[model samples]
Each structure stands twice: as structure tokens, then as C-alpha cells.
Target: MFRNGYKMKPIIATLAGLMLIVALACAGESATPTSKPTNTPAPVATATSAPAATVPAGATATEVPVPAEGPELTSMETYMQSSGYMPEWGEPKTGGIFKWRVSRNNSNFSPNMSGTTHGLFNMPRYGSLIRFDPWVGFTSIIPDLAKSWAWNDDMTTLTFQLYEGVKFQNIPEVPESYNGGKVRGDEFTCEDVGPSAERHVRPPKWETTLKKGQRSLWHLTGVTCPDGPLGYTAEVHFEVPLGKTMSALAQGLMVMLDKDWLEWYNTEHPAGMTKGTNEAYHLGMGTGPYIPGEFKSDIVGEHRRNPDYHRDGLPLADGIDVVILKDFTTAFTALATGQIHVMGRGSWSMTPAQVAQAQRDFPDRITVHPNAHLFGYGVGFNVGRAPYDNPKVRQAVQLAMDRDEWLLLRDAGELPGGMKMLALVSGTPWSYSVEELEQMRGIRDKLTPGGQEDVAEANALLDEVFGEGNRELEISCMAAGVEYVEDCLLFADMMKKNLGIKVVMESVEPAVGTDRSKTGAYEMNSGAVAASTDFGDPDDYLLPKISTRYNANSSAVLRNLEALKVNEPELMLWLEDTIDKQSRELDFVKRHAMVRELENKIYYDLALYIPFGQRMAFPGTGPAVKGYRLFDLSLYSNWSIWERVWLDE
Candidate 1:
């Protein structure tokens, strides 16, 4: 049986130099070993000795295998032991300006915004009540603004005790800049925390726009502020029972802002303060470790370490400079040439050739870390449309394309089994069983022979749905100008060759894909869905993609929306009962069966979005860079302990 309780250990070794392979491999499955030399010379480093740590008996100590025998092999553990860079039981070195090349500038910085741009910036600089430590690989709730929290009997209401020393960076009346200025005020109190929570629950202007021109908080239900020592104890009530609410709140939602600064920023920059405007550039008042210093729209954003940062001793870096390189090629070049120390979100841009070249050229300078969560990129067919409205047509399309072939064509390396349908959730707690997957394959086999190059089968299904005519099907997809547009064209070409179905490609803005998919405007929208870090439940996989509430806007594409809406209550109840009664292993099996039923109904036919075989890449310096870990890919990744990292140089 696969152990669900497996936790990752902190990477403790520092290689003088290391070669990292950053291929776009298939999701969920381990990569096939390539014929590469393992005993390459280590990069020269200032520190040459490693630390010693005992490996517990019976604990797994699997060494990464070297492919070809060339030079004597030195284990990464032994390398760290020989080098004095191993992490000791104390805070890491913390002072240096680390420059990172980012692909895009943030559109908004508010934690409440649902976009990826906002989500990325909000998590690192801002302090969460609880945070994930990638080094130790555990979730820890820290005493930042909130000192302590307790749960109710039903796990519904969570009351938090606020810390007194916490203070927002720039309140107008106090006039203390983030640099060396001093603010004449008591440490942040319940007055700040209470109102902030209350506002999220019931904003004064429910539909009002923010200073950044973004939408207001209208989705929240209620927030009750604290009264006494207890002044910090605020009660939050939910509309429905949510198990991950605390985690979500701790992740970023509960980030506190100073009331004075909020009011001043709004007054000083009335027009700029709206949700979509670039007003956040002028306003930086969070109690985070870093204070926003400079902002160049779509070019760069600089943040200086906060001198008054509430964390006892954190944010080891002197400053963080984020340079936005919208082009992947430019970012990759920067990483290869040592123009930047780190690169964020470079996975989608790396090709097979680039991965090989990086390993060859800058073998010792870079380290690549794969994120554990599912990041799916697939095609979504609008089921409300005519041709796809037919279940047989959808099934025929699934049968026509070989997932393995598509992976090879796409240059994606390896993927977990059953990844063709559910690209991201292939091997986790939510992965489907092999038996159930085989049953799905049987359904596909009945429609096509060998499930590859079945032109007649595809044509037969297309003709059955649209009738025997020269009338072509219009499958609207994003233009090739977008990143994954080629994948859409690949799907189109396969369908035309095998099924004799001529699909007219419609290209539009990337946002149009999201709009069309949500509104069911297009017959099919080839897009991708990235899983949030806190996601563990299968509902996280299914709800936004297919739930009635989420799909209401795209109701046009859902032929059976009305029927599904009626059955939603029962489905939700079934999901809850399944969760309560079975173990996680059985729960995944049951969930897989349930989602398979939905897939059969053809609400949306799954297409290869992630293009299995592509591996995500996170490039960073070796262990000499303090606070650096292989898993520091995102906010949820190991970089959360920024204060713990220090420069050895």
C-alpha cells in the first residue's frame, strides 16, 4: 500500500556545484532515467566543508543514482558533509540583495484578488497567521499579528488572539517611512485586526472598487470583531462548513492593513486606489518583512527589508529586487548567464533543448525543483455546443488522440497513469485507481481500435453527430500567439486526420478564453487551471471546473446545467458522506468514480492541457545561498522562511 503519511525531509547538503535537469516531464510520474553523466566536476565554492547528521535506522536514505560511471561518485549528502554549508539548528545568514527575474509584473497586490499575479506577491512579503515551511516540510502557524487562535466544537468558528507589537509600515498620522523613520503610536492593536476582518465580511461598499481599481469584497458573509485581551479575539462565522478555512485564512486572507494608512491612501490617490489601477505602487503599509520601495509598471518592482519588521529575526536578505521579464527566452538566458540569481514561473517556457543545454552549460550554477501539487494544462470542450453535445463525439475525440504520442510531440517527458484525463491529480491523495482507470480505457477501446490514428472511427462519430455533410465544425481556440495554442492546433489536426472532422480554429485574447469558457460562448476553450497550494480535497479539483455555482456564468455551455443544478445538493451530500465514511484511499476511488460519471455525461470533455511529460523548472543558486531549498518554487514552497536564509559570502 502507498503510504499517505510520507513527509519530505529538509534538504541538508550543499554541493560545490550541481547539475540540474529541468525538463517538462509528464505530471505525477517519476521521470525515466536519461543517459547523462553524473560525476561532473562540482562548481568551485568559497565554503568547502559539509555538516554531519545521523541518518535514523530504518529511515529511507535513497541516494539519487548517477546514470553513467565516469568519475568516482560523491553523494550530495557527503558533499554537504565535506562542505561547511549544512544547516545547523539556528537561523540562517540573512543579508544580501537577491535579484530574481519574474515573467510578469503583478496586476494587483491585494490578497483578496483571485488572479495569479496578486496571489504570488501577497504570500511571501505578507505574514500569514499560519505558513508552510518547505525546509522542514510542515505547516506552522506563527505569532505575527495574531498571537493565538482556538477552534469551536464544530470547527466552524475560530477566535484569534492578536499580538500588540505588530504595526503596519506607513500610517499617515504617524509619518514613519519604512526606512529609518519612527512612528509615534502604540503597537498595532485589536482596533486594526477587528475592523479589517469585519470589512472583509461586510465591506462598507460591497460593490465598490479598491484603490487599485479592483472589485470589493462582496462574497464574504460575516466577521465579528474582538472586544477585550480578548481585544484581539475576533470571531469569524462561515455560511457553510469548511475544513480548509483556517488554512486559507492563515495562507493570506487574514493579512492585516493599518486603518490610518488605508484611509490616507484612499484620500491621497482617489483615482489610483480603485481595483484595476496601479495605485498599490504608491501605497505600501503591510506589516510584512519587505516594504515596497519602487515600482516600474511591467518592468520591475523593488522591495527593501523592513527595519521594523515584526518577526523577531527574519527576512535575512537586505533587499529583494524583482525584475519582470515577460518573455521566457529572455528570462532563461538571464538565468543561464548568471544575470539573475533566481527565476520564478519558468516551467511553461522550458523546451527539451533548453533543458539539455542548461544541464550542459551551467550545470553547477542552477538547481531545479519540481512542485508537488497538480498544475494542469488541458483543453476544455463546451458541452452545451451541438457536435460536442453528443457523448459519442466526445468519447471519439478522447479515443482518437494517443496521450503518450501527444506527450512526445509536445516534448513533455513522463506523466502519472490516467494523466490523459485528469492531468494534475494523477498520483496524489486524489488519484484514481488502476482498476477504475482500466475501466475508462475499456470505454475508449470500444470506440476506437488501439485508441490511435482512428480516422474512420472519428469520422463516423462526427458524421453521427453533425450528419453527413461538408459542413465543418467550428472549434474556437486561442491564437498561436498564446503559449499553449500549439497544443490546441495539435488536437485540431489529430481530429481532422482521424475523424475527418475539419475544425475551424478561432483565436482570441487569452482572457477571452477564460470569458468564453465561463460564459459558454465558445464551443471549446483550450485553457489551463492551476491548483491553489492549500488544495487537498477532490472538491478543489472538481468544484471550480464543474460545480453549479462556479459554472453558472458558463451555463450556456452546460446542456444539462438545470438537471445538474437540481442534483447538486444530492451530489454534495454524497461527497460529504464519502469523505466521512471511508479512508482517503477509498475516498479517492469513490471521487474518481463520481467524476467519471460526470465525464460520461459530457458536461465537458477533457483534453490534454498540461500535456503530460513536461516538467516544471525552478532555478536557484546552490546551498551556499542561505535559506535556499530545492522546494522553494512558490509561496507554498520552501521560501516562506525568508528570515532564516543568510549569505555565506
Candidate 2:
């Protein structure tokens, strides 16, 4: 792997510009508004009108077009300047089917209750109040559904002015009985924010189902529409300071659900229906650029462009045809053919070797764009189980890990060192620099003496714990996807060879694996295979992930995590409280030091969670997909950029 001289992407500021100062200042005196509504449409493709997307010779555009009033959407122009657009992409042309892929099916259409396959399905139809600027660094917070926002002198209080006349999709799916005879296509307003926020953090069935919503918006203490239901002003109060609040808002993670729709849903399914199994589960009503259409689990999903969408000159393609391909080899084959225009996401979608091979073989057809990756994977042990209950056994597993081999396996047998190095934005207080990480004990080349020394020490620890030649463990290898099995097998082999222990494996479905983790029924496995977040904020990644409790796309990887809730209540509560102290710490220098120390002590010291390291991702797309920018600083943040992408050919 020779350097073609590709530089690593710049580190995104953890707090995102003078936000730390602004938040602290608010404690003393009132602060000014951060952004205001303005007329600023994007320059790219404003001159050209998108022609009707070409369909089959006889097949016409399925939906009727709702012509724009003037030239473009008034609401759309106000925030376009915040996002970056490429000059080389030239004039945008519209009206073509944007074919894509997702590795698996979404559990449901609701972002609140659905399983996390957000990029492909849920997000295209819904939006958040604020968002990170598309095609730029993650530092800037831009308006989405909101026109502008301000922070009061009190750190907890915030206010928002929303875009007026924003209307939900006007589909005939909603019946008059559902919302007191009001059509579902009515205007979206500030009053809707209250109910949407309530469902997000405090859903009705607290213990039974739908917890991902709570994880996404845990900071907010209250959200309200000061005026009646149709008012455009929203008042919000969060328990934390600026860092935690902005991270939750800027990622488009909270897709504002329709208030009337929620009332209807509660009336119909009192106990909350099982995730997406029923016929009514597929329905969607949103203010975003697309409308949900046909879907078949683990097969395909269709999103038709919303003709009445408020965003002007957006969603250049007529629709997106999403095909689910679970296997990487199969996905590559589809990419080589004309089956799909691009891979589903840039992060962890393909290896560097695959991208290079595609360039050499299909340069004329495929164009791969570079992206920064923040996601990593590794083994998570259930500490409530036997030998794993002993801290020595957990420490031995991480010490014996051949980290370089894990990277090599992920990189398609080639070591792309110095890319992610088990950390995001290395050299900062959050993690070590690339140079420093390369020489460390666990991360350095295993053939080196230092690496071998770690393995020897690991063996000694295991012997002391299990009384020499009497140690064995069975890992429940989660069958969530093919990669999960591969990572689990590699880890089992490493532990057996390095520490000389007997390892056995059992395969279980994703649903079964989640249950096993919750009840501490499994010894160890790849539970946190894609541990990731939307931004560079330390609190955003640290709190929901390793610090407190993890239960979304990536399961918890810490020892005693599940057991701590019931068995060691006080210890867990004290440790969680201590970890969150960094969030409230205002001083930049002090907070940086606090973040590093907490990470070392809370995450690495106990060896409860082992990281699989990071990677630089390349999203493979067709040359026809124009105006698409390389804005992947965060693993899941850039999916919203699809709004600006248009087709040329």
C-alpha cells in the first residue's frame, strides 16, 4: 500500500466553534441568536429546470406533478447557502431513477420505532429541526425544518422560528376519522414539535418497545409550542449545555413525526404493534422530499419524489429504487453491472482494495469518492457469565487481541495503516496521534517484540484466573449479517492461539442475539460491530455508547453493562454520573483532559469493550450521479446530502 498522497480529512472540532464559550456566557448574561432566516438559495443548477425522469417506454411518471408557484420554493432558498455544492458538478438535470442498495431491510417506516436502516428509507421522508451542513465539515449547524434559532442567557432555554407553510405529503392514505377530519397534508407548525419531542424521549410503553427514539433525544427536558397548535415558534429547554444539545439536533436524527398521526396511531394500536409486521406499519406522512412507496423485507424499497415538497430544485431524481443486497460480493457484482447507481453508504460499505480494483476495471462506468469513517467493531463480553465475571479474564481477551489482523481482515487482506488507528481525529485530547498509535503495545505489528510480550502477559493472566489448562468459553456469534460472523470467528481464533484457551462458537439470529445480550445469556461475541455516531462530539459518541448504556444498532460492549442495572445498581449509577461530568465541564482545556482520562478509565481500563479500529471509506457511485459531494466526516450524517444530487446521463 503505497501513498498516492491522499491526506486524512481534517478533524472536526468536538464542540463546533465558540459554542463552549457561548454556552458558558449564557450562564451569566443572555446570548444572541445563532442564526436568522434569510434568502440564500444554492447557486448550483438553479438555472436549469429538471425534465421529467425517463421511465419505461410506455410507463409514465406515476404521480401527478404539483407545479411550483413562482420559480422555486421560497422556503428552500433560505438555507441552501449553508450547505456546500461543487462547481464541477455543473448544472443539475432532473428526472431519472436513482437506484441504490441497502444491506438489509428496515424494521418499520417509523424512525421512532423502526430498526436502524435510516439512510435508505426513513430519512428521505422525514427531517429534523436543525442539521449539519451537507458537503462541508460537521462544525456548522444549518436549518432544516427550522428557519432560525436562538439561545437565551439561561443555558437550558432555547427558541426556534420554523419555516411557514411547510406542508406534509398529501397522500390519500389518511382517513378523516384519524385526525378529527383534518387532512394529513395540512401545514406543519410549532405545536407539532411538542408531541414529536414527547414521543422521541418519553414514548408511551417505556419498558416494552421503541427505545431508539429515547436514545436519540435524551438531553431534552421539555419542548413546547408557546402559541396554539399552528404557531411557528417553539420553546425548548434541555438539561445539558450546548455540546449535548447541538449534537442531538444537528444530525437530522430526530425525524419530526406528525402530531395528528401520533394521536391516530395511539388510538389504533394501544399497546404499540410489533415492529413493522402489520399492513399499516408501512404508511408514512412527512415534510421531506420523498414519499414512501412499495417495500419487501430484505428485498427492496421504493421512494417516490414528493411533487409538493417545499425544498426547491431538490431531489433532482424522480425517485430512488433501493435494492437490499446482504452480501458484499453480491453488492460489488451489482455495482459492476448497472443494477445500482451507488452503494447505500460510504462507511464500512467497501474496502480500499475493492475501490482500487473498480477504478482499474470500470473507470469509465464507476466513480468512487473518498470519505472519512468514524465507526468501529469489536467483541462484547457478558460479565454476568462465569469466567467473564472475573476482571482478569476480560483483560486477558483484549491483551491477547491481534489488532493488526482485525484491520487487515476489514481492509481485504491489505493493511491500510495510519487511517483511523482505533480513534477519530487522532492527536486531539480524545485519542492518540497516528504516529503514537502505530508504536503502542496492542496496536503495533504483532511480529514485533512488544506485541509478542502483550500476548505472553495475557496467557499468564488467564492461567492465574482459571488455574492453568482448565479454561474454555463459548461465544454466541450473532448472525446479524455475514461480517458479524467473520469478526467473531477472527476473535475466537485469536484468543485460542494467543492465550491457549478452548473456544467454541454458536450461531444465533439478530433478534435472539439481542435477547441474549439483554439477559446476559451469552459469554462473548461481536455485539458492537458498527459502533458509531453522527458527529465528532465526545459526549455524542461517549455517552450513548460506552459511558452509560448502548442498545441501538450497536449493542453494548461493556462487561457487567446489562447486569449493572439490576445487580450492582449503586456502582453503575455512580460510574455513569462520573462519566457525564465531562459534558457539563465548560473549560475547553479542562474538558479535553477530562474526556481523555474518562475514556481511558471508563472504556479501556476494565477491558470490558474492545475496539476493532477505524477505516477510510470510499462510496462507489456511477459517473451519472452528479452534484454528490464527499462529506462523510461522520458515519451517518452525510445521508441527507442526497437532496442536492442530480443525474447527468
Candidate 3:
């Protein structure tokens, strides 16, 4: 059973070091493992006696098989243990806060509505029923709020055994605590889980402002907490026999909401504030290891350690202080100046050129995690608008794009190595392969090295659409991030050079970028988005992204699809039935075939989006930063492991 979850953009910037571009190559069923290795020899520190093994940047250490004389390896657990990855660290001593910098200002901590920034901020506070194990390249599942879970024979129903004593945050200062009856925190129960599950599908009208809530709740029919052998047992019934039910419930979509608190909040607050309410942002409680302490819009969001955490020896740090910056250069400067302890993956945090510069400047402090991210940059067209509404023009733009050139310019003329992705979601069985992608139009003969420009094809398409040489395009992008700004400029130049289009690149503030995207205010927009394959399934990518009604990005072609579904009932029915069957299909081989078929239709046949290279998350930390690692390459799930991190200095 596998399912990929709806993915948003990778952290908007690279926080500390150089952004190393690592190519993804499939090995069996698992996604490529992301490794962060230092460039120089192991630093001599008195913290431990043994020196840590250093795998070169952009390389995975081959797992050597046990000798014939030794016992055969059984599972990944044994392999990882023997591979020296499970090194014993000295006893953890917790005290200091880990200062981290995020590129974008977090709007709010609302689970369903928030983007990457808000998601990361909420991670230390929230808990899910099931979670992707980061140590295993997210190939395995681990318990979170739910202690144990199982699916019935037909896979239509999932039963969860919750941890009986877990409690929500008890921050008395928050307004939601004034819900009269209890001045203290409430116990996390199936009552909370059932209402949260129901709320996932039946979001309030205000939820329309939240980008990805109801759209992700597909297949889930109802959640019940009936009397069972074990108390606090919850059964989640699905409309279809979903193979990736566990994976689907592992992301921000499945965070258990405090139903009582929400009801009280709605009663007290007006609809205006309740739509994107600050009360829900700050007052929301969870069963995790931290509670949100302070929030200064667009500047900082801080969290204090949860004193009444369920886990033993949790939240090694005193607190986490996240500084919100607009761009990566500032973040990089802060990391260098010792203002921040770690700089994570962000849209603008680390550019390829900056990475090269960082290696030259701070070789000892920098480390690169290659092929760790699941999202990438793409050129989105508003199909509802003119000129771009034409498929030929879209194809022309895709064909004219010199990906190889962009790679060179983006990475300072160096190929840092990355695989071409046919679909938005890579690192999974359903992701389109090179040979398969090569067979598609616009991509057939447009590769690197000796590939010629497709100016003729592009011009012909434009000529047919808007006569000869009348092609013009306006692009919308954030002005803060260097990578995004440069990409817009590069694409604009390419459009003019190849298609004879007059390109207009409009740079807006971070908030304005979101507003523009929602309004479909540009002919094209460019940026990288991060998505995760929580269960190695195709539904994650197709459902939230391709469906116009599912995503808040206001995808031009996707929005058109919603209109098409209304106008063309037969096509909608066929699509709905095909996608549902694909989701329920238990056979991996058959499901993969169906996934590839749909991807071909979406990418090649429709050409709604022009997929750029897949994203790579480079997590860089200071010398004294200990136990800081990216377990799951997700916005919310990665920060969940922050509790395990501690500061050495």
C-alpha cells in the first residue's frame, strides 16, 4: 500500500551553505536516499572518540553485504545498523535553543491552510496518527499520536489504537483556553480524532481560503470511535479500498484538531477573523513537544518546550526560535555571522552560485543533502487566459526552454547533477522515466550537449496562434528570492530569443506572489514546489495538483479542468472512475501502469505545466549543531524530529 501526499514548495530558500544539486536514480522500490556529507576530512572534536564516516557529497555509500562467514542480513534495520549509520552518540545534554532561519514569513500555524513556512512552524507542536520514518528515506511508517494501526482484509477500513494518556497543549495565555469548562488542557481522545477526521472532508465555508484541506480528504468516508476491545480505538472508513490510507493520513491533512476548542473559538470570533484567523493560528493546541510562544508576523515565530510532553527525554533544546527572512542571501549572512544555528531548505535560501561560493568560503561548516527534496520548479500557464490558453503556445514555450542552459546559469555554469522529471512528483514508482519522457512531444529531441534550438517549431506555433512574431508573455514571481528572480529573467529572455515574444517579468513581494497566484494574474509563474510520497503512491501528486478544485495555487490549466468537468460530463466521469480505480488497485504493477498512463496524458497530451528539474534540499548547520538532521523531506514532518536535536555548544 502506497500513496504520495499533496506537496507544496520546498523551503523557499537555502538557509546556510551551498545548494548542491544531486540527481535522483531509482534503486528498487525505495526513493533515492539523501546524504549530507562534509567536503573536508572529519573534524576532530572531543565529543566522541570515533570519527564519523564521510560519504562524498552527491554520493550514497553502497551497502556492503555481510561476508559468507557472517549471518545474512534480514531487513533495512539490520542493514542500517551495520552500515555505521546507527552510531552511538554520547549522552545528550540539552540547554540552548537552536536558532534557525526560514526564508518566507509564516502566515499562520493552521494545519490545513498553511504553506511550507506555516507547516514547518507547526511541526514541533502537532502530531499525526502515523508518520514517515525519516531515517529510512521515508520508505517506512512509524507511530506518532496513534500507538498502533491496522487495515481490514478488504482495505476499506483502518483501525487506530491511540495512546491513552496523550494531552493537548496547555498554554493558559492563549484565548482558546477561555472555553469556560476547563482551565487546564484536555486529554487527546477518539472524540478529538473523529471530529478532526470528519472536519477534514467537511471543512467550513471559511476553509476555501485554506489551500489544501478538503481536496486531500478524498476516499475517506467517515471516522468513528465506537466501543471496541481496546478503549480509545478509532476506525476510519474509506469510500474506496485505498491502498495508501496510512500514507494519506500522515501529513498536515491529518493533524487532529481540538474540536471543543474550535467550536468555542468559532462562537466567540467573527467570520472575518475566523476565515484566516489569528486565534486559530496561535491558540491551536497539539500533543507534540512544543507550544507556540511568540509570533511577530513576517519576522519571527518562536516555540517553547512543552513541559507536559508524552515522550520521555523529549525536546532536548530549551526552545526553538525561528527567524523569518525574505531571501537566502540574508539567511546565509545570518548563518555566517552566527545569528542562526541551522539553515534548512528554502525557495531562496541557497542558490547554486551561492553554494559554490560557500564551498570556497566555509568548506568546514557546509554540508549538502542531495536528492532529498520531492518537488521542483515548473512554468505554470493560466489556461483560462488568452494566448496561454492555446496548447500549441504552451508546447512552444516548453520546447524552446533550454533546461541545460538554465542549469548552467542557475548553478554558475556547473552541472551539479539532477534528473529530469516528467511529472511534478518524482522519487516514486509512478514518476515518469527518461525513456518514457523522451517519447513525448516537445521533449523528444530537446536535451543537452548537441541538441539544437527549436526556434522554428516555436515560431510556427506562435504564427498560427497570433500571426508571426506577435508572441508576448508576462511572468509573475517574488522579488525577494534570488533564485526565483533569476529564473524569471532567464525564462523571459529565452521566450523573447526563441519565440519572438516580448516578455514582461513582474516581481512582487512574498505576500503579493500568493495573491497573484490566486488571482491568475500572470501569463506564467515559476517556482519550485515540494511534495512528498508518504506511501510511494501516485494519488498524492495527481489528486491535489492536477485537479483545479484541489489546489489553492490557482493553476491555470487545472482551473480549466474544473470547468471542463462541468461542460464535458463524459470526460469527467471517465477521469473520476479511472482515478478512483487506480487509487484502489492493490496490484503495484497494474497501478504503476495506470499512473504512467495518466502522467502521459497530463504532461505530454495536455502540457498544462512545463516541469523543470527536480528539487534538492540542502540542510546546512553550524559546527556545534548536534543531532540536527532531516528525517522526512517534508515541510511539516521534518520538523517533527526537531525534538531529537540538541545544541553542543
- What would the per-residue lDDT of candidate 3 be over residues 117-165, giving only the tens digit for each residue? 6656766787777765444433345566776666676666778777766
Compose the digit string of candidate 2's lDDT tens values, residues 271-368: 43344442443455678888866766666677788887766656778887776777664665556555567774744355555554454445555566
TM-score: model 2 vs. ground truth: 0.75
**C-alpha TM-scores of all predictions:** 0.68, 0.75, 0.74
Q: What is the lDDT of residue 59 in candidate 3?
A: 14
Which whole-number lDDT from 0 to 100 does residue 561 have in model 2?
64
**Clash count per candidate:** 51, 2, 18
Model 3 lDDT at residue 470: 68
Instruction: Give residue 371's error in model 1 in angstroms.
Output: 2.7
The 0-to-1 C-alpha lDDT of every candidate, in the order given, reads: 0.44, 0.59, 0.56
Q: Write model 1 residue lDDT over 285-375, tens digit each, in one string.
A: 5667776656666656676787776554456688766666666655555555455566544343344444444444445654443333235
Ranking by TM-score: 2, 3, 1
Score candidate 3 by lDDT: 0.56
